[model samples]
Target: MKRFVVRLLINSVALWLTTLIVAGVSVESYDADDTLATVLTYLLVGLIFGVVNAVIGNFIRIVAFPIYLLTLGLIALVVNALLLLLVAWISELIGFGLSVDGFWWGVLGAIVLGLLSWLIGVLLRPIMGRSR
Candidate 1:
């Protein structure tokens, strides 16, 4: 439970950072004037992203194993980008969530988001006492 919360927060931070660094990827606050609403929206979107990646993303990765081998893992970038786009689509359907400008932007945002999440996770692992 604690580990799950930690990962969620890490993902939220990564998504927030991506918004700052990636111009084409951004989250829309449910309440435009409310700071708390904006933060919570990011966290919620992060949660959606985690769930989407864990479920659909895993299935797709498993099915695309051959492509992964053929591309020497470079296909991971495309996979991640597609996952991000999926998250954005899901969020949009639900009313408030991420908005990706286009395919290439999604790719770049996914790359940065992955790096940020990985770095943050590594930094937090010591304090979090490792994941089970």
Candidate 2:
């Protein structure tokens, strides 16, 4: 499925931007003073993020849809927060060392992440030069 794979890659890029925006943490390191390693590390982190988001995010969103609708979509924010928390949990499990500060941090992170995703999608849709 080319479409699914494309979406998966986009998700990875989005997650990378999220970490860049929220944590200011480095993703990978190769040497004592190698920025390239850090870049690749982020790419790896992005892949992990995409997997966790794809599998876990789907379940969470489905279960929360009614709450989202009832709150006139306000609950979508909470849902996104929990999803980020879940990604942190998965990262820890996989030895990636990511953790949300708390529920409030997660909420703020989710909001920022959503905005970043929107901006990336808007700009990338033109750059990738794909018409769909």
Candidate 3:
């Protein structure tokens, strides 16, 4: 659907920005000089990230609800970071995608990606129409 495509694009852009701002988090393209390949790489990573977060991320959140409550939701940062690392791992299997240096880098990258995604969503809300 249009909404899904829009979200994918938003996440791709956010990931690109995150890589630019975070030294430890980066994306590898099939060909550095090929803009289309680079763009597809980002989009592919974004899709993987979205899928991983939707499936594994939700399951973890549900199972860790008690811990989340105990930690006043602070555990979410760690969980998100782990999810980001999971994406990196999955991408690694494909030989070219997201590359996170370590846990701290994953945490920082997740924070940056989340913020950028939120900001982009807010800015595009009017154009995209109000959510139900």
- How many residue pairs collide in each prediction? 0, 1, 0
Write candidate 3's Cα lDDT for 8-127 as tens digits. Answer: 999999999999999999999989999999999999999999999989999999999999999999999999999999999999999999999999999999999999999999998876
Across 8-104, the per-residue lDDT of candidate 2 in tens digits comes to 5565566666667776322333342676655555555556666766787778778877887889988878877887777667666666534577887
**Local lDDT at 94 for model 2:** 63
Clashing pairs in 3: none
Give Cα-based local distance difference scores for all models.
0.95, 0.66, 0.95
Those runs of model 3 whose alpha carbons end farther than 4 Å from true positions after fitting are none
Each prediction's TM-score against the native?
Answer: 0.96, 0.71, 0.97
RMSD of 2: 3.4
Q: What is the C-alpha RMSD of each candidate to the true structure, in Å?
A: 1.0, 3.4, 0.9
Order by lDDT, highest first: 3, 1, 2
lDDT of 1 by residue, 7-120 (tens): 999999999999999999999998989999999999999999999999999999999999999999999999999999999999999999899999999999999999999999
- Superposed by TM-score, candidate 3 places the C-alpha of residue 57 at a distance from the truth, in angstroms, of 0.8
Stretches of candidate 1 above 4 Å error? none
Could you tell me the lDDT of residue 119 within candidate 2?
Answer: 75
